[model samples]
Target: MDWYPNSDEQLLLRTSARFATGMAPAVSGARWFRDLERGDVQGELTGWPPGPTYQLRSAGDKAARRTGRALLVGIPLVANLIANLGGASGTPLGDVPGRGKPDEPENEVHDFPVMWAAPGSLARTVPWQLDPGRRPEDCVTDLVLTDRRLLFLATRKGSLAKADILGEFARDAVAEVRRMKFSEVNADVRVTFTDGSWVRLSVGNPDNAERLGQVLGGAVRMLAESELSEGQFDRVARFRADLPKTAHPPTYSRLRSGVTLVESRIPVKAGSGLFETHSILMDDSGQPAEPAPGDL
Candidate 1:
């Protein structure tokens, strides 16, 4: 199996560093990809989707069952965590039909640590830890889907679930920010940011400045009525308009988008109840790390 990490995986590790604390040094492209190509990454990437071989219906049936458990449980979630974790396995298959040629038998399972965490659950956070050999179930981080990218915690516990605050500010350069429009009714839409900023916009016809608060939610604090100002609006319309493409094969498919697409279960929000969905890009980590928002 190839031990070198592909270009995309390297991007994942670097971008992920903004969120994961105590992450191991970046794995070399060769050795890293080698482990993954050899299926050794399955042990590293807890809850990661199996390879293309298992992606086929005939092979993926069992995988679907394991991921389906989230729907049945109250706090169902999935996350891709990077850490100093380790595992063990037994005997690597020799001459499997589709598996090129056989290599040395890996009859035992071994585990090591890496950097990067992409979980899909609200219960967990960024900068968290995952010991696949121990608690594999709690490695998920909840994500709120934006127009193109997925929003998750930067740190596992109490820090910002979003990535670096400076990163968001830089995102304005790319114009991925979008503001909801409202004319008649009060939008009442809440804006949240990763830096603990939140604000209620369109509570009334007051002014557009109040709406700006919505875009930077989760980062700055909610503004008081007295603090609100129309001049406060940053007219970042250009930034909101230039978001990256989410097409099947993205526009810049050549930058070696390290994110590996997975057909995993995603818990979509449906009013009061949540449902599991078997869809592509369910929790893909191959997204590149632009100077803007979270890579994933």
Candidate 2:
């Protein structure tokens, strides 16, 4: 019989040659290719068009399937498994309670909490006497800031089931929110309540740490300037805690070139009971040099 090349046969030949030559280095390092080179040709065909060419085509098809599986099936499964294993995970937006749906009526604006527990850790912790049944590892918690309160809710890890109500500090109970440096690029925050209970939390990123400081600092300033009863003022003053002496007030000025400059001070530790100032700059239109998205 005389041999004649069909379109499929001709294209396959071209593709096989191109891929083998172009990917020689990578393919040569593969065990399959090494085995083929070592004369293991029973499972891998030998000869033209039906040999290495066929093997290459089959391998390509398998690689495509593996990539697709990784994207469509493997990733989500692995993520879910990790979350269930008490690795870091966040609640889905849809699952968050009392935050109205798209069509529902909006409540008054409430800022998100500045710092909370990292994923895989307990949301809040109390003395063992307070809750003998709860262990830090078994719970995950979120800190929420509402107009009325700074709330901490602990939930069972891997599920949103309520585990315990850790603490709820009304705005009046907040004594101070201090930014403590942990590293050059990261910080931890401490929230002191009037009752003397305090919580320290890690802020995962520097930007978030700064925003937390700004928002809480601004809130304290606003409260200080507002008209309040003597009792109310004392409560708010607890949250202020000499912030005016430790941190410089934000300032605004216009340059001769018409670019407005806004300056603010951030506190960094100098020594025991001492802090130095770090300057932050922003434009008059309210854009910071380094963008602080949710900061006031």
Candidate 3:
């Protein structure tokens, strides 16, 4: 559980961050080009474009290669517009790479207010180094949540390099964590700071993304192995015994109804550097049970 933020800090949650360029939160949507850099949530759409996106469009690559990539990125030009039009809330919103005019120039700004800080907020200070658009292809980043702080770590992808602690913020600095179900596979989260500034982040794993929201937002109570009752402990032990050796240790949490949810992550069989979560719910009798109302 030790991390760059603090040795001995309990590692509450960790998730793989966006790796492909298509997962960028700065992509255009209904909130395109909205600047939150000055903490002005209603400010004009004058946000600065991410430089790396522009670099891709520079005279370096062949015209055909650039055009081909653009089509892959722009076909929809804003899929969420259908769901979020008129500034109303929607659910199960699909994911978007970048959205704009079908032939939108690559140099244009595509910042969404949820992901771009207008000003004077903590999100504005998030290091560009964590941005996939700006980082190297083999680099990997992780957003780590612990009892004391929230931070990002950088590591060389598929390498043995030690993870580097890039940046961190005191837990108190976070004011809210919202699950954005509208995203593709329901894997996006909006992290808001105490000053009313927020940034949208896409966790590569949907289960991890939901866990980050539920735990950080206080919607459910996370429990440790020691907190389990004798019966529950035995059930969990047997469950873990049957999991693959590569499976991560199970995490326990209790809903308001006291139903225990135990979940674990295991590597995908394809070994494609991805993971999926497996979860089970138990009642007080330590028997598998269906989720209770409001327990989801």
Candidate 4:
């Protein structure tokens, strides 16, 4: 059967996509705190300790990688949905106001690194080996790592064509710094590489909400370390260090908060199956060691 969206799935996926983008990548499962802080989603950090110096934690197994891939592709929202759907217990209803359903049963709850596998599918592919430590509940929601490229998948309003894959950015764990942005589908986005060459991207693929993410990801350009300062580098490095040890950690930060995070996900599609793959690198929860001056 073709991967057609049921009405409920459509609503859930679309609604999830909007809110999903707003859901912040968590540090040690404390993502709720970030969501609450933004007033996008609700809830509080019940046991979180108060401190100006918040500890950065590592991401859980695949969950971290999945979240990373999502952010890399500019689909953090979709990634969050995939991660939660693969684990959390909820109706997957569009009307629900939160990431987790208030009425979800504890018995049905799932952890991060939610793995959905389908063998030998050409429509989708993933590089799961890259992240062996991902969990079902971590930010890295979906993943696909291959020799040619790394792919992240999220539930979207439409589908993605292969051509959209070009001009997108892939996760670079070894990179000194990374940046992401979201805007209108056709908005002109510029990427200046450290080498001075720049790439520009415009969003395409209206069929699948996930497809738009492919456009965003394909537009990625890598920057040189010189672009970031000592403090920025330190912030990214510390976040990387805190990510779960699945593969090399992907470093990231919020321009709004200046708090760095990491996460990624992958998608695999065969003739008859479509699945989600994931991995995690870092979490911003557990106390991270303060970086020495100029060490970043």
Top of the candidates by TM-score: 3
Q: Compared with the true structure, what per-residue lDDT tens digits does model 3 show for residues 166-275? A: 67899999988866554444556778889876676767645566678888888878776777888888888888887778665777788768888887655453333355
Estimate every model's Cα lDDT from 0 to 1: 0.22, 0.31, 0.58, 0.26
TM-score of model 4 (CA atoms): 0.22
For model 1, residues 150-245, the per-residue Cα lDDT tens digits are 233222322323332211222222222223232112112233333322222222111122222323333212222122223222211222233223
C-alpha root-mean-square deviation, each candidate: 22.0, 28.5, 9.5, 21.9
Model 1 clash number: 56
Off by over 4 Å in 3: 1-8, 19-51, 54-115, 118-120, 160-162, 269-273
List the candidate 4 regions with Cα displacement exceeding 4 Å: 1-226, 251-296
Q: What does candidate 2's lDDT look like per residue over 217-288, in tens digits?
A: 553122212334454335334433534553434323232333322322322332111122222233433333
What is the Cα-based lDDT of residue 33 in candidate 2?
Answer: 17
TM-score of each: 0.18, 0.30, 0.66, 0.22
Question: Which run of 10 residues does model 3 get worst, by summed lDDT?
Answer: 83-92
lDDT of candidate 4 over 1-296, digit per residue (tens):
11222232210111111111112233222211122112211112222223222223435644774566555644433433343332112111122122332121211122111111122221112222112122222222222332233333332212342211211133342121112232222122222323322222221111223322322354222223334456656655654464444322231322122222222212333211122222122223422333223211
Give the higher-TM-score candidate: 2 or 3.
Answer: 3
